[model samples]
Target: MNIIKVRITVSLIFEKIFGKLLKGHERSIQAKKNIALSFLFKGLSITINIILVPITISYINSNRYGVWLILSSIISWMNLFDVGLGNGLRNKLSQTHAFKQYSRSKVYISSTYAVLLIVSIGIYLLFFLVNQFVNWYAILNVSQASIYNLNEVILLFVGFFCLQFILQVINVVLTAVHATSKVSLISVISQITALIAIYILTLFTKDSLILLVVALSGIPLLVQLIATFWYFSKQYKHLAPSFQLISFSQAKGLLSVGGYFFLLQIGSLVLFETDNIVITQLFGPNEVTSFNIAYKLFSVLVNVFTIVITPFWSAFTDAYTLNDFQWIEKIFKKMYLYWIFTIAVAVILVMISPLLYRLWLGNLAINIPILLSIAMVLYVAGFCWLMIHCYLLNGIGKIRLQLMLYIISTLINIPLAIYLGKIWGTAGVTLSNVFVFLYMDILLFIQCKKILNRNATGIWNM
Candidate 1:
């Protein structure tokens, strides 16, 4: 009788604390679970990255490390060539799953894979044809003497890049299924494996960029490949992308939705990815390292915020499809509270960054100015805010306004980044990025509110 009373009391307390937040709706329950799991996996992934960086720097020197960073950024542009099909597949697949359209889902999956495979092949053959003609050393603003096997190294990077490009669609498929935590787990595994590979290389090999590229790029691709096979053969086998299911008609529907996403991806590449190249060109590869170290430090806040919001894209899609506005409104209110909490953490992170830099980079910590850290904090704050709004709009397939906004922002970023980079160095480039994020934040916040309240009209509706 005493034990029964105690159990009843504990259950009542749990209900009182989390009844609405955790137990009210199926969507809420799934989002909460994914967010919790993402925090666990992403925390481990970030820790591995932190440990991986210093070791990599010690192994290859900061300049070469910076070169690797810039090259990786440049190659990352290849992801855009999917023409939004990945995101198209994500949103479309999510909708199909919600409606239990299993056969259509398979067609969507197969068609996306077929299209991306064709794209990857074209990209690889194009690179093979042109690899010898371009002077990579001049393009990257690195000296030939500082690097060797340059063409071969780029070829290897591109090869791995194209293959990974096709395989990583599995991540999008997982996200669409509201299994975002699984995506985070894959990332954690890949990063951990890369860290281990780098450690082994340090012990047995000379500091060769080619070998570093192989270890860093190869491991992740291998993991994703295994995941693709395992998933297709098991849990998601029914929705597997088979050759016979390739449907250009389904592909057309996906492209219709994804065209805006493709453009947005391009604009994002310019806004975010070009900073390293700008830093390397205006300053040097060494400055790129200092800038990146600071970025990696402050990006902790952005990464954490992403974990909170990542699962919500598909959640929002489901709610919108079902006309569940009240749930969307309530969740946005909670998200606002979380956003405020993130801003507080960002300020705290900046306050202690000097000590962090010292511990994180040891003697390599001398160059990161307090100003750069401050700039990064502002950049992170704005980026996180923009993400909260953008995810909702994307989830609902109302992205025309976002597409237009990105075009305007992209046009402004490159020149502004160059101009500011000349005066403020790397911090200027970051501030330029902050400006773009701030612009999007104000407009997107207004748009999200209008749409949620059913007051959206004209461009705001889109």
Candidate 2:
């Protein structure tokens, strides 16, 4: 058939262009497949997210939407309470799966789940006790008149997030096994469900932030819960978490690595998540909305870059385990080329961003300054550049340098963000992030190069 001939012609062009680099390598082949499928799912997820933003803004005013963004950022801090177990489990499970050690992977899985479950319960209890005195309305810089149910909304979101925290471990588990496509599929389903729920709310119910929170937070949790049960019962049944496999001794190994990751998580939260809090405190919620709108627009490139490289975290683990340094070198070259492409795309997106905002948000797009879009382009470039080295280091388990850099970044970002926000408004906060990410990117790139060249020593090797 003509279709078959076209397929063959396209295959020939791909082979001719990339040549033997990906021809015989099973890791590269599998990674290509993951990238292909992830693009499909993530494309849908991105579209839904873009559509959700305008729809959400329509349902609630910009100030309330800004409050929601701030609250979500604050609640997301609790993900650190997992103490890096999720990522630790990711690296550990990837290594185990590489060696065909299913039993060992199961023990790691169960141990991580047991620890997260206990941590989630304790977090819920601790927050319940702490929530009474926190004065969240004041912290959010919103009036009680605007959101009387702020406390109840916080309580409801925390409850859903606590449960979702445990159930979402399935994502890490799937990624470890090179099943990131499934993880993307799960996210798409959750996003679709949330969109439908919100659409229904718009049809029947009055605009209530509480109901918005329920639809946004609760639906994802429900979907993840179903997926956790379904995946464990079928494809991953052999590695399901159970009381029998939960081992305190086994947990120490995960914590040993995860502990460092835990500290890094806190540092990351400070570096990335505090922008909204700072904007809300200093510039009010309206500017926060503008900052996020710009951020969301530019984040498309970051997400695409992530989809391409996500599979390589585990692939790097496999290669390093086998001492296949040449393969690592080849992949790094390919990644750099991709990074160059992202930079080009970021430039183009920045050029057309005003038109994009008009199309995406209509009148609501007026407040987002072009300066914010420019800074966001810089942020995305730094982020994509940093992720390349960071993932390889994490996969190869050389993160002491990354940990130190994040600590320094954490210390530097907040004051800089505040100082810059005062000077440049919301754009200043974003530029502050750009400065930190560029600093980290340079150092981590050095560490990655040294390790890959087999010349790293002392802290770099660590």
Candidate 3:
């Protein structure tokens, strides 16, 4: 009787262990599938963008095109308003979803949407006020002949720009809700349509660059908003916000989270986008165009890696919420290896960047090999740091530390970039990024290690 009882107990234990292993295996497979799908969409979009950029640059002279790049960079800084709301909401949703807390998930989603909408309105107002006072013409270094035209068209462009920014927040909400495939599809189609429309419009209105840019840029957001509304209304009817004001408690949570994320965004923008401004201000708009072309081409590799990792963010959040330290560690190890491999390939490509640039743009203005190779290395390092930070800190709600690191880094980036740009020109500016990313990464890793260790201990105790 004792032997029979012992055998039965051991069998039950083995079965339970086997079941868990099976579930983990299944989850790993699902994670890979999701990552691949997300990567496919982003890869296609980037490929299309690459094919179109040369044509666009050719149509609009390099100087004028550089102005576009600078304007876009300025707009990229405006993403500070997103704070970290998308990430915060994603973490919350992943946790709630894991536990089958459907009602709470709906509330969280609605609250996040409401908060983002309010923040978007605030950003719109800020943009308007800045537009009214700021001398965009001087900043862009527009020729006297073009200055009057730029001033006349600035307000109209700002309006369209604000509309596009609001749509971006809505798109973020869609991403948090795991509706990214739909968003990605809409993004690609709308962008292709807009590109085609711009090409057609240019034939008739060759001189109306501002109007062309505004129309082409704004129309895509309108399409995205329509797609978002249609999909969310049908698929997530329960999460639909009534547009009523969110409670103070909910607002506070979003803002507190977003404020930190906002700082981080500003820091990252300072590190990445400030280079163009510094280069243009120190050298000229032509140099800006040269740098941007090389940077964008090299960024294809970085962006592909980002797209591959993004879908896994929600999964990391879910695992963190469950205190699954083993799974988290395993995932991190796999991702680290993959990132290292991807970056190695990017470095190799950088060796041929000069040839690639000549083929793409015809008689490059800059040393594409040096600029792209340095930028590629900096970007790859930054990408690795970002994945670890997002998985460990952002996934688990330790964003305040990230915010602190970003603030310190931003303070460093401004002076360093300006000083470097003055001394070495564009190369100096590009080289400074390596230092900035390294500083931030080291700080983040130290903090993350402490958090992971503590959590691992807790998991073991549990």
Cα lDDT computed for each candidate against the true fold: 0.91, 0.91, 0.68
Lowest summed lDDT over 10 consecutive residues: which window, candidate 2?
A: 16-25
Worst 10 residues of 1 by lDDT: 16-25
What is the per-residue lDDT of model 1 for residues 57-104, given as tens digits with 9 covering 90 to 100? Answer: 988888999999999999989889989998889999889999999899
- Stretches of model 2 off by over 4 angstroms after superposition: 1-22
Model 3 Cα lDDT, one tens digit per residue, 1-462: 999999999999989765654565544655655555667677778877776666666566667777777877876676666676665666666677667777776666667666666776787677667776777767887675643566546556556666665566556555555555555677777777778776776676654557556655777777877875876688766655555534547656766666666676777788778887887788777788877777777778777776656656666667777777777778777777877887787777778776777787665344453754666666666756666665567657676666676778788887887887777777677777877777667766666666667743332211
- lDDT tens digits, residues 343-462, model 2? 999999989998898899987744788888899989998989989998998888898999999989988999999999999999999999999998899989999989988999999999
For model 1 the TM-score comes to 0.96
TM-score against truth, every candidate: 0.96, 0.96, 0.85
Q: What TM-score does candidate 3 get on C-alpha atoms?
A: 0.85
Error of 2 at 234 (Å): 1.6
Pairs that collide, model 2: none
Each prediction's Cα RMSD?
2.5, 2.2, 8.6
